[model samples]
Target: MTKPGRTLLKVQGLTKRFGGLVAVNNMTFDVHEHEVLGLIGPNGSGKTTTMNLISGAFPPSDGSITMNGQRLSGLAAHQIARRGVSRTFQLVRVLPGLSLVDNVVAGAAFGYRKRWGAEAEQFARGLLERIGLGDHMHLPVGSLTYIDQKRLELARALAGEPEVLLLDEWLAGLNPTELQEGIDLIAELRREGRTIILVEHVMDAIRSLCDRCVVMNSGAKIAEGTPRDVLSDPEVIRAYLGDE
Candidate 1:
């Protein structure tokens, strides 16, 4: 089976600015198919802004983004998602009134609108089981623990069948065991041939999961290399320390 990470998503000259403040500065990178690329930075480093641009939350100030040779510039978020891209937010977006199955079904519906009828619900049920939420299929999303909610978000994104999945701080609030589970889940996704681009503050996850990493400081790409190389660079170290 062909892996999603084997394909390449090219982001070139991607820049975004709010007035005189540049949130992302001419950043360029490639997310390889079937690989995990970790994106790390301190507060206000434009990590979220970069994710927003690539996911089509807004148009880039100046740049071109392409996936599988398709131009992604000027597309809306949903449109981009339909084009084989999906993202999980830092805040965990799920419907409180919906059941676990329903939340994932909603995601399936987004990509399978034309295939409605019994098929949609059937597909959602299968996906929920695959995501390890079979037992909670009928439980209200609001009643699940925080960890379960995070899993729901993952299942929703997975429902899109995206070639590229962007995870924004997915492990932020988890305890040690939960964090490990999340890490293993992501790693398993990679093994299942999914490509992932993760923005995280957790160094341990980045170190264990990413094949390569990109470091940003103040909205600019300061370094891109192996985790050890970038993490140990004097410049990168100082940047983390708030020095120029």
Candidate 2:
């Protein structure tokens, strides 16, 4: 088990409003270095919205976000990526026309440290190989299966060598065996001390990966603690299973 270190990301009183609806309300949390923090909730609970705010895909309507004490709330998505934050989308996104290696190379060239030319291509290739896409490096992304595309997206995110990796349901569409493979891959990442914020509906993955969990319902946090504790919390149970 990796012991969590200093606070790496801080989200304080974050809120977002879309017209009359509040997507996230006054949420606050701290993600420690080397920790896998699970953001778990039922559908429509603002989990992805919160992730969007953190990744700069959507700016918060209120409150602040900081990484290692540097303000991140106002930065653009690309700027945030350059500052060591990388993410895979809830829906798989890959460059359909580009070869797998080119897709990852894009990430390496534009990511945090900005590798270029041979260095960038080499780094991208290694990441693809690590993520099990080496044999298909030159193939167009459109030719890959859904799970393989997911793998490519993750590799692209990792190509940046990000300080914090946000995985939004990277395990969503896997079959039983593929799910286990996905889980094991993530476990390896955890062992490598990657700091991650995972927004997922798979309880098994949550239990196996998360050091702690924060549960939300209707865009507001309802519970937080270890997976064992939070999963058993009455309110969290109610949020998922409904009141009886």
Give me the candidate number with maximum lDDT: 2
- List residue ranges in candidate 1 displaced over 4 A: 1-7, 112-115
In candidate 2, the residue pairs with backbone N, CA or C atoms under 3 Å apart (3 or more residues apart, or in different chains) clash, namely none
Model 1 TM-score? 0.93
> What is the number of backbone collisions in each predicted candidate, taken in the order shown?
5, 0
RMSD of each: 2.3, 0.7
Decoy 2 TM-score against native: 0.99
Q: Please give, for residues 1-244, the per-residue lDDT of candidate 1 as tens digits.
A: 2233444799899999899999999999988888888898888899989999988987999999999999987899888887888889989999887777777777776752423557767877887787677898878777888888999999888877788899999999999999998988888887787788899999999888888898999899999988889999987898888565
Candidate 2, which segments miss by more than 4 Å at Cα?
A: none
Best by TM-score: 2
lDDT (CA) per prediction: 0.85, 0.93
Number of clashing residue pairs, candidate 1: 5
